[model samples]
Target: MSIYIDPAVALSLRGYEMPERLGFGTAMAPVMFRAVCQDGCWSNGELIPYEPLSVDPAAKVLHYAQSCFEGMKAYRTGEGIALFRPEKNAERMAYSAKRLCMPPVPESLFLDGVRTVAAYCANLVPGNSGESLYLRPFLIGTQADLTVSASTSYEFYVIASPSEAYHSGNMRLWVEREDARAAVGGTGDAKVGGNYAGSLLSIGRLKERGYDQSLWLNPADRSSVDELSGMNFFAVIDGALHTPALNGSILEGITRFSLIDLARNLGYKVVEGTIHIDELLGQVASGTCTEAFACGTAAIISPISVIGDDGGSYKLSQVPGPVAQHLRQALLDIQEGRVEDHFNWMLSVETVEV
Candidate 1:
């Protein structure tokens, strides 16, 4: 399909200036990518000004919650500007859309939308370490129907943010025992708004109790470790890296995947297995587990210092884990083009002339 570049988009981008301080996704780029689908047909994507969206009050997304999104970054590497494994984000978004009973966005269209945004907004890509142009691509059921069914129409949007790295340093995590963010057979593995919405209350309650994020447990067993609110969980036990195995419920994090590979390449033993919460806490207490951390696209790696519940608090011997620190830097080096792209992961983007 043909892509349209609106003349107004260029003006919008040129007039845009980066704020002095960008708090994660709060700083929005001036232009955005938009496309619509009707009766299972997709229109050509367009580059347009970022503006408030118009949606009917009775839209299906408003009621049934058929929405999905992917988080990615456009990095300013030493060579030039580029994106990190965008195709993975595209594939994951399609998986998420399918889980919500929505049509999967075609890969070519997804790549085009993000690449165009990154190319045109290359000037907005942050130059500092751990900073980049954050990209959020989302699709919502827009058929303006109140029926409890999937909408026949949809709208896809790609928005950009020039922002700082999310650093939840030496976090104190709460062992969430009550609320289940996603169920055993639910959208736990999918990156959808509802899953995050369900987790907010837990995060809020934890924050009130002096914790950073919720360490959610498996919905089925309610015993094994699942993941953090949005990131994957990892622990360092006896000088080896251990994480929860994928069981059709954990959201497969791109960073988590990269870290495992990077750790092994760096000569650390990485294991993916089921970790019971009680057992892990005991290990922490016994000094067998020295470090733990959560990882995702936004934060890259956030070290976890303590795990607490009503019973007690268990602290890791290492506040900022050696494995986490090593892997985080290794991944960032490859991402920032400081080291060789041995994994062949980074995708370069030639900036579009304004």
Candidate 2:
């Protein structure tokens, strides 16, 4: 598919300046990639100056929350600017769009939107380890109507930000017992906006109690571990890596999947199964579960120092333990191009002339 480059995009890119402080997704790039779908027909993609979107007040996205997004990164690698497993992101976003009853952005179009934005903004991709050009590709329903149904029109956009690691410090998680982030047969597995919106209340409550994130339990039983609010949960127990099995309510994170492969390659016994929260806490208390961490695109791996529950706090023996440190460094080495991309994860993108 052909991508149209707006003339103003060059001006915006030229005029924009990077700030000294880049905190996660706070700093935005000057250009954006966009496309529209009307009645199942998608338009050609376009790269334009980043600006406020003009949407009707009665749009389905505003009222019905028919929106899904994906988070990925463009890294300044040894060879050039590279995207880490972008195809996986495209596939996931397609799955998310399908869950919302919206037209999935074709994989080619999704790749074009991300690659075009990353190629043009190659200079904006940060060179620091753990820092990169954070890409957010999203699809939203745009049909203007008050009735509740899927929108006939949709908008897909790719915006970027130069960001540092999402969380640099060890996290203290709250074992959420009162609320469920996603329903049993709901949009939990999909990266939709409503799933996150429903989780904010739990996060807010946890923050008030001096916690970093909410470790959600399976909605079906509320006993087995599901995942953290936005990231996948992992724990090192008895010298093996254990993560929650992908039940219907868990969002299968790309980083989580990669870690499983990398860990097994590094000779660690990796297990994916139902991890009950109580058993995990008991193991932690017994020193069998030495360390725990969360993984996602933004925060590659954040060590968990403590798990707070109503009963009491269960602390891990090591914060940023040997396993997490090794895995994080291993992943970063490949992402920053310090090591070979044996897994064929990084896809290099040539810089485009503005």
Candidate 3:
């Protein structure tokens, strides 16, 4: 499929200036990539000016909630603009789309959308450490009928934000037991809009209690650890790196996988298995679990200082454990091109002269 670059897109990029403060995915890039699908046939993609979308009131997304998205970043590495493991994002998005009965976006098309947006907005990517152009690719059901079924038509878009890292300091987590974000046989593993929508209320409730995030528990048994709203949970137990096993319900995080590989290379034992919440809290209290953290594309590696449950709270022995600090730095070094790309994970982009 051919991609059309609109001339107006260049003008918008030229006139745009990024703001100084970028807190997560708030700021929008001047241009965006768009494409549409109708009755299983996809239209040629286009680079267009970023604008508010117009949708019919009875769109399928509004009723059936068929939507999925991906979160990635474009970095200003010394080798020019580079994307980290974009193919993983593409594969994950396909998995997410399939879970919702939507057409899986072809890998080539997904790469094209992200590359087009990142290449045009290359100049706007922040140069500071832990800063980059945050890329968000999403697809929504657009069929203008109010039936409780998957839409026959869909709209895909790639929006961008120049932002700083999500969480830089230590994060205090609340052990969520009363409410579950995703269910046992539901869309828990998929990066769907509904999963996040379900988690917002829990996050809001935790914020009121002065907590930074919620460490969700497994939906089935409610005794094992699952993950956070948008990140995967991890901890250092007995000087080894430990994370909750992907039990058919945890969203597989890119950073979580990368850290697992990097930690092993750095001589740390990495374990992926079920972790009982009560046992973990007990270990934290006894100093066997030295540190705990969350990992994702958004919140790189936020060390957890405290974990509060219904009965009491357990504090980790180390806020930013030695393992967490070392692994975070190692991952960031490779991402920002400060260190060698030993894993060949970085994909260099050819700048499109607009």
> Alpha carbon lDDT of residue 187, candidate 1?
94
Candidate 1 residue lDDT tens string, 176-283: 999898897899999999999999999999999999999999999989999998899999998889999998789999999988888888899999999999989999
Model 1 misplaced stretches (Cα beyond 4 Å): none
After superposition, which runs of candidate 2 have C-alpha atoms over 4 Å from their true positions? none
The 0-to-1 C-alpha lDDT of every candidate, in the order given, reads 0.92, 0.95, 0.91
Q: Cα RMSD for candidate 2? A: 0.7
The top-ranked prediction according to lDDT is 2
Ranking by TM-score: 2, 1, 3
Task: Give the range of the ten consecutive residues with the poorest summed lDDT in model 3.
Answer: 16-25
Candidate 3 C-alpha error for residue 165, in Å? 0.9
Misplaced by over 4 Å in model 3 are: none
Query: Mind giving the per-residue lDDT tens digits that candidate 2 earns over 1-354?
Result: 899999999899988899999998998999999999999999999999999999999999999999999999999988899999999999999999999899999999999999999999998998989999999999999999999899999999999999998998999999999999989889999999899888899999999999999999999999999999899999999999999999989998999999999999999999999999999999999999999999999999999999999999999999989999999999999999999889999999989876
Q: Please state the error at residue 327 of candidate 3 in Å.
A: 0.8
Give all TM-scores, in the order shown: 0.98, 0.99, 0.98
| Alpha-carbon lDDT of model 1 | 0.92
How far off is residue 140 in model 2, in Å?
A: 0.3
Predictions: Cα RMSD each: 0.9, 0.7, 1.0
